[model samples]
Target chain A: EKASQLQTQRDSLSQKLQETELRNTELECQLLDLEQRLENRRLESESFRKSLRSLLELLDGKIFQLTELRDSLAKLMESDSS
Target chain B: EKASQLQTQRDSLSQKLQETELRNTELECQLLDLEQRLENRRLESESFRKSLRSLLELLDGKIFQLTELRDSLAKLMESDSS
Candidate 1:
């Protein structure tokens, strides 16, 4: 009587453990997927930063050239005015 | 007799299930953290893009102004020479 009851409990608990382990594996897979996605996003962000930096450098170069032109123009105007 | 064996088996499997549940909870928490971190990085990336856009607009404006200045200077020189 009591023996049969214990046997049944043991079987039920073993089943529960199996279910739990299966669920654990599923969660692990999901975490791995999230990690991979995050890695890709990080790479994308890094490339964006690199591209922006180069663009800013190019704009800075253009600004420098324009400033030089402006200065020369100012000098010419000054000579003209004088 | 057999009751003792079954009871022991049930206890051990119950313990395993408990431990597995705890680990599962921990994994869920970690996944939540990764999601939050990814969200933050995405927002940061968006802001960076916005900043770059505005900077490019400002640089375009500067270039336009410089070109205008250059054109006027060129006209002045032509008149001066003529």
Candidate 2:
């Protein structure tokens, strides 16, 4: 009877082990998927940052051109008045 | 002797179950941490996109102002020559 009880306990433990292993496998898969998603986000953010930097540079150039043009207009107006 | 052997088998299975449970716990913790990191990345990306959209709007306004200024300068120059 004691041996039968031990056999039952062993069976229960084996079942629990199987369930735990299955759960572990599922968690591992989830981890992999999450990691991939995170990597994609990092890449996307980097690309966005690069594009933003270039756009800022273009704006700077346009602003500088505008300043020069305004100064030229001012000088011409002053001379015309004189 | 057979009962003794069965007891040994049960002990080994129990030990394996304990180990598997421990591994599952670790994997679960890893999953939680990864999920948090991914959420942070998403929020950061959203913020960056918002800033980029505003910057583009600013650039458009500047360009429009520049065009107007250039046109005024051109008209002044043409009238002066005439």
Candidate 3:
């Protein structure tokens, strides 16, 4: 009788352990997915920063050209007026 | 004899259950931490996107101004040539 009871107890424990192990595996998978999402976000942010830099440089060039053109035009007008 | 054996089995299962519970709690905490990290990354990405939009608007305005300046200069040159 005692042996049978012990056998039953062991069986139950074995089942519980299997369930816990399965749950652990699921949690680990979830953690991996979350980390991957974070990595993607980081990359996206990096690309945006690069885009910002390129845009700023392009705008600066345009501004420079405009300034140069305006100055030359002013000089021409002054000479013509004189 | 069977009763004593059953008691022993119960004791062992109880111990195993306690240990499993502890491990489960730890996994749960880890999962929470990972989720928090994901949230922070999402926020950072959102801020970056917002910044990009603002920068694009500013750059557009600058480009428009430069184009206007260039057009005015062309008009002045044409008038002088005529």
Query: By DockQ thresholds, what CAPRI class is model 1?
Result: medium
Instruction: Give the alpha carbon lDDT tens digit for every residue of A1-82 in model 2.
Output: 9889988988998888889999989999998998898888789878877887898798789779968978996898789954
Whole-model lDDT, candidate 3?
A: 0.79
| Clashing pairs for predicted structure model 3, backbone only | none
lDDT of 3 by residue, B10-65 (tens): 77876877787788788889889988887877787688678878987987897799
* lDDT (Cα atoms) of all candidates against the true structure: 0.87, 0.86, 0.79
Top lDDT prediction, candidate number: 1
lDDT of 3 by residue, A17-81 (tens): 77887887787788788778878877877886788789779868977997898899789878895
Worst 10-residue stretch by lDDT in candidate 2 chain A?
A73-82
What digit string (tens of lDDT, one per residue) describes model 1 on residues B1-82? 6788888888899899899999999999999999998899889888877887898798789779968977996898789954
User: B1-82, model 2: which lDDT tens digit per residue?
Assistant: 7789889989999899889889899999999999988888778768867887898798689779968977996898789954
Question: Per-residue lDDT of A3-71 in model 1, one digit per residue for the tens?
Answer: 888888888888888998998999999999999999999898788778878987987898799689779
Q: Which ten residues in a row have the lowest lDDT in candidate 3 chain A?
A: A1-10
Give the poorly placed runs of model 2, Cα more than 4 Å off.
A64-82, B77-82
Ranking by lDDT: 1, 2, 3
